[model samples]
Target: MKKWKAVLTALLATGMLTGCLGNGGGSTLNSESSRIYVTEEGTFQTATVESYVQQDYYNGDELKTFLEEAVSQYNGANGQNQVTLDSCTLDNGTAKMMFHYASPDALIGFTTQYEDKENQVESIAVDKLSEVYGQSESEGVTFIKADGKKADQKAVSKRGESQTVVVTSANPVTIQTQGRILFVSDNVVIKDSHTVQTTKGKSYIIFK
Candidate 1:
C-alpha cells in the first residue's frame, strides 16, 4: 500500500518479519535461504527466503499481496514482463519470494525503482575484465578460484569470450552460475565451483 520497500522496512521495524539471517542459498529444487541463479544467457531468478513471525497485527497474506502488486506494477510500467513474481508463500513464519528477471538490466531497473541502491549489478560484459573494471590486469589484479585458491594466471591471461559479472552489494547472498566460475573478486566468499557469495562493496565473477 505504501510502496513495497517502505512497507517492508516498517514490517521489519515492527517485528512482524523477525528471524535469524541466513548464510546459504537455494536452487530451483530447494531454496534454503536467499540466492540468485544466473544462466549463461544472463537471465536469472532470485529466491528470497526470509524468516518471519506471526503476529495478530501483521498479516502475511497482505504482505504477499503487496509484494505481488509491487512486482506487477514495475513490470506493467516497463511495458513488458521483464520482472515477474514467480511465487510468494508464508509457511511456519518463513516467507519465500521468487522473482524472475528477463535480464540483469531488468533486475538493475527493479532495484533502482525500489531505492535499493546498495545492491547493483552494473555490467555483464564480454570484454576484457581489466577494461571493464578499469584496472590493470598486470597490476596484481587478484583473482581467486571458487575454492579460494589462486586461479591460474596463465588461464586468466588466455581468457577468450568469457562472461564477466560486475556487482556491488552490501547484502549477503549466494550467486549460482551454470558455467564453471573461472575467478571471483577478493570480497567474494567461495561457496563452490559454481557459486560465490558477496561480502560487501564491489565483486566480480568470470565464467565460461
Candidate 2:
C-alpha cells in the first residue's frame, strides 16, 4: 500500500511539471509570433499574425524583383505616386538601397512588403530618417533626437506589442495613439494629460 501511494504521488508530480512546461512553451511561442509594423512617419506598430502577411526574401534577386514590382504597381495605380530607386550599393555582403518617392504614404506602402526579418531589432537615429525601415529591430528599437532639439514624432506598434523607445529628452515627446504598455525610465515625462499613470514614473496607454 505504501509503495503504491509513493508511485502515485511521483506520477502526479511529473504530470504537473509537464503541464507547467507546456504552458510556458506556448506563451513564448505566442510572443515570438507577434509582428511589428512601421508606419509612414517612421513609427513602429505591432499586430497579431492575422493582421498582415508575413514577408520573406530568400535571396538578392528575390528582393530586387519585389522592389521593382512594388514600384511598378505604385506608379501604375496612381499617376502622381512615382517611386524612384535613387541608389543601390553593395557593402561587403550587405546591399544598401535608397528610394525617392513623391508621397510618404506611397513610399510606406511600397516598402511594407520588405519589412520582415531582415529589419528586426535594428536601431536608427532620427537624424537618419531615410534608413528607418531598413534597420528596424523585431524585439525592440530606439529612436533618439539630439538634446534640446524639438521633435514631433509618433510610433505605432501592433496591439500587445512589446518594444522599447528611448528618447533623449521627454520634453518633445508625445504619445498620440497607444495599444502598448509603456514603461518609462529616468528623465522621461508624460506631456499628455490623458495618459493613465500607473506609478510615479510609469504610465499605460491603450488605443482601441
Candidate 3:
C-alpha cells in the first residue's frame, strides 16, 4: 500500500473519535464561538504521503473548507454521498470534528489487497490495557500488557511516538494488529473518536 494511504488507513482503522493537531503530537484547539469553523489543526502527516492526494487543496479553497462544508451539508440532511462525522467537541480553542470520508480508489485498492491476504488483517479489537493506551488484537498480533508504548510505522514521528498502545508478536500465528484510544485532557484533548481500521467482512470490538 502507498505510504499516505497506509498512514491514513491506520488513522481511520484506529477509530479515533476526534482530535486536532499542533506543532507537537499532542496539540490543542480552542473555540470561543458557539460553533467553530474549518481548520486542519495538525499537519497533514498521513494524507500528505499519499500520491494523487493533497490534504487541503481543492479548485480554490483548502480541503478543510470542503470537509467542513461537506460535514455541515451532511448534518443538515442525512443522505447518501455524505461522509459521517463521528464526534464533535471543543479542545483548547479549536472546535474539532472527527470524521470519516470516502477513501480514494487507490486506498481502496490497497485495502482490498491486504484484505485478500490469507491472514493479513481479518479484524482488530481494542481493550483498555492501561489508563492511557489500549490493547489491540488481530490474527498474528497477540495481546500483551504494556504500560504506554508508541511506535511509528511511518516517519510521522521520528521516534514513532504515539499516544496509543499496539503490540506485534512473532509467534506461530501471522497477523497484523493496531490499537488506539481517544480521550480528552487539559494537556491533550481528544475531541472525537472513530475507527482506525475495518474491512468489509471484518469487525473490531472495543472494551470500555
Judging by lDDT against the true structure, name the best candidate: 1
Worst 10 residues of 3 by lDDT: 42-51
Off by more than 4 A, model 3: 1-50, 53-60, 79-208
The candidate with the higher lDDT, 1 or 2, is: 1
Please count the clashing residue pairs in each candidate, in the order shown: 0, 16, 31
User: Best by TM-score, which number?
Assistant: 1
Give me the overall lDDT of model 1.
Answer: 0.64
TM-score of 2: 0.28
Query: What lDDT tens digits, residue by residue, belong to model 3 across residues 25-122?
Result: 11222111111111121111112111122333112223345445645665455444334444443223333333333322222233233221211222
lDDT of 2 by residue, 1-208 (tens): 3342243234333432111001111111111222222222334432211111122322445445544665677678765446665433322333334455554344345434333222122221111222332233342333222231222235323322343332222112222223222333223333232121122222222222
**Candidate 2 — what's its lDDT?**
0.32
lDDT of 3: 0.27
Model 3: how far residue 107 lies from native, Å = 18
